[model samples]
Target: MRRPAHLTQGRYAPPVPRRTLDVTSADGSRLYAEVHGPEGAPTVVLSHGWTCSTAFWAPVVRDLADTHQVVLYDQRGHGRSPAVPPAGHSTRALADDLVAVLEQTLAPGERAVIGGHSMGGMTIMAAAERPELRARAAAALLCSTGSADLASEARVFPLPTPGGRRQAHRRLLGSRAPLGPVSPPAKWALRYATLGAGASAEQIEACARIVHACPPGVRFRWGHVLYELQLTRSVSRLEVPTAVLVGTADRLTPVVHARRLASVLPQCVGLTELPGLGHMTPIEDPDAVAGRLRDLVRDHLATAPAPRGERPARQKKEKTA
Candidate 1:
């Protein structure tokens, strides 16, 4: 398999986690999770996209860990997380894993600003209505993801007909082919499909390494799930303040998906469209992604009111008095 130069050189390595643990999901899958920064700080939990690992969020994590307790995790079968059985692959599984991570990582009554990229965003949507999510998530950022019609809307194939494009995307998603080598042509293809025209060598290398590290079988399984995704109801159920971000040139989950999400989300805080960027918005513009996350942490997560079901300890004590 072809690996990126940075993977060997450690140029864009993920920040060392203060602690690492295996979080057991509802179905008994052990997800690899890491926590960074000081305890008791406002928390930010991040989920990565399809065919990507926790390392994919390195740039953003590096920026956030200075002031926020940043949590990063690999999806089942990706990164340090071991491959799960075939039956364990689905949007529902994604939701279950996310809930487990939140439950295992946070202290009681503490909440986080959760950010998901691509498939990770879909995971948030899948868990939107769950009591665990509502209790643990103060705010959310959905990046480069859609609720449905993924294959139909993706611009990966420049075919003339919509049917042709959709068919091509489906085949591509279902393919178990390995990304064999990171040659110049391979990098070019990666850039065309995922990144902006302006992505630097280092950014491309970082993204390439993370993506290529994913096992082909695992990629095929998750890609098939994405191809058939339908989480519109989940998006509607996401009651927390949410922000949407997408690149104008995104081929995977286009700007239209972002627009639809903003329209349907009950409490959408904002939609940010980055011009000329592609599906890999976080890597394409790490500063912008990190800045938006910081804004959400400051404006929403940090000051979010306590859950309606729970009274403050002082208030409860006064009531007893």
Candidate 2:
């Protein structure tokens, strides 16, 4: 599960400038991240899913920087964080690291409003285990992600063949090399296979580049891990105000999973069902995702007054059509 040398650093940095912070993980691995927005505002820590880095949040981050302090990081084995021994990577361990990052990065008594896209969402939900950190945050947004029983390999992408998961996992562990450099043909195949018919060529090309560039080893190992996870039990434990958003057309982590999670979360206040969208809702429609996040922030602010000594903060008003 250690990151192979090639994909350890992101092939592309986010196209925006933000403050970079380095945190030394418990085992001495260096985890790096970028912060956006006014330093005094409540921090919104955005965690990317498996096989993704902070760069994946670029679109959503771009829209919210003005109103909320945002922190985005590559999870261990994904972006700038040095890969761990594959055995060291687990949902709980990642969740523990999240608490550390939140404690170190934010001012005393300030809790982050956490959001995660896929496995990223799983990590946040799992963070509920840390009572101190969980109590500091205002709300949580689980987007295009779900809990354990709600999640399945079939729900993520088309089910890999029997043992497909194992092969991908082995390849990622560096036991074998990837099929080859992601090529134009492979890109097209992915779009057709995952996007369903009529998916745009431009979208396909862009996604292909990102996938192609990812560390083949990281991609394979994480893919297997995702297949084996059951995050529903974790979702049931999140006590903070929570919201769920899902694309109607998501082939991976489909809306059904979102629906199931919304039913179990005691604090879930909103469920957004975006029609005609797929798994990449946050990236595919930044404005739509931002609007929902803005609403969640506002609701959390309204219901619970800010903690004493916390900085004065406000959510941006979404523009009326």
Candidate 3:
């Protein structure tokens, strides 16, 4: 169902899924997944970043679900997905969760265009060599992410010295401090660190709600993953045709990260840097992100017919449990 309220420019209301399911990851983590749009349509599977959930993808889903089947899932401890044990918060876990979602949601042997933002993009890089990713990803969209130097490259705190900046950003990345509430100060902080100066209040509120809802422990653990992330070698393993996008004013993962990603990806298709945008590229500018996905579908998925969500004889719908 369309949300008329979020339909207005720069507004973000969570999209209602046509169907929902639980996907079990390799380590027995259960992820909440949703499917939207019509049957027999081009499919896109979107993964949100750290401290964000399926709701983080709402605007892009709303934009594309009118014509493309959109798949979204909560990261292990976000949204309806339950929190994991101590060792369950690594990038490997992120990859495992993505593989499970793709396997469960798509019909057997069916593939879709995959997109990731921030930590989600790192998840794609982490899963680069997975058989599931190699098999199921037709193309990829890596948005507002950095494969390496996340802590050192971030400009959120902006300390004077590079050494001091690294230490400061490292602390910021791995901090376990709770975000008490989505107050005005909190919104301002979140907006300043994540969004560009031009971001509207509605966009800030939408993102704050999702990011603040993340469990502190979950956020802490994933924050550590990002802090220690090193995936330059893995970028080449993402052999599929891939496009990258970033915002010019992105403080978390800057345009330099996007440039590095574009240079290393084996089949890098294109990289578009949006001016005056931030780390929340899809939310701050959904149309641009959705347009890139459409381009991927047109380029790579044009020959593959969309699979009906059914089997041959009994005509039963595909099982996504």
Candidate 4:
């Protein structure tokens, strides 16, 4: 997807990557991946959610780049990556593309703390049992995602009857409706459906542009997959030090998902529910998300050296104590 200049400029402007790679997935679809920060530092690979690109991680990357080598990739049919190939959109394809990204970007035998937001989190869970993910994932951060009953549980529309809600949500999920330009009404709808009440105009606009940039066909395909998603078994198989985070006000994937995941994750380190943030956690509260990641790297990846500038106390001290 080609993003407009204003949408990718200013505070959310993507960090200049150290290198960008055109990764080929198992089915021969090309994936776009960018590596940022320093080489040889403790690595962290970030996967953006549905309807987002590497640009979604701009704030988080800006915060983490000083001490961490950050990697960002666009999922199939999103961002600069070519549209989905003939293999079709499925959880398996998500898993395959993630594996392909790791295989291409990481040095052999090198592991990194991996993190995902929303569908990106599902990508990690979907790839839980894969040997490649198992080999290269030192830890994981699951932010605002669910493994099962996603359409049923989502609070986006808040319909009255159970059957009606499910039906309505399904239609909303797989509607193939075109999201027009980021107009004020479009921002209002996006804000109501996806973001928290406290979202600023800038945050809403940034999210609106990204969400609108996604092709309706691509959105429809992924939406259908999510509508029928069944990944509870996979969540149990994500046997790594994993932390789950969610926005209490998230309409898309509520805190219930985070709670369920916390209960099921094999080695859950923590579950954070931000009081008023929404589904766009990375963009809304980049500092908190980035801070949690820093904690994970310090606690789980201390053996791996950081770049020269960052001091140890900076990494360890929650000194605002």
TM-score for candidate 2 = 0.80
Question: Considering summed lDDT, which 10 consecutive residues are worst modelled in model 4?
Answer: 312-321
Best by TM-score: 4
The positional error of residue 140 in candidate 4, measured at the CA in angstroms, is 0.2
Q: lDDT tens string, model 2, 9-69?
A: 2322254545888876656667778788765665678887766677677668777776677
Better of 1 and 4 by TM-score: 4
C-alpha lDDT of candidate 3 relative to the true structure: 0.86
Per-candidate Cα lDDT values, in order, are 0.86, 0.67, 0.86, 0.86
- Model 2, runs deviating above 4 Å: 1-13, 149-182, 193-202, 302-321
Per-residue lDDT, model 3, residue 6, is: 24
Q: How many Å off is the CA of 41 in candidate 1?
A: 0.7
lDDT (tens digit, per residue) of candidate 4 on 127-237: 999988988888899988899888878888787776666787899889888998788899999999888899888888788878888888888888888888999999999
**Each model's TM-score, in the order given?**
0.92, 0.80, 0.91, 0.93
Candidate 1 weakest ten by summed lDDT: 312-321
* Deviation (Å) of 132 in candidate 1: 0.3
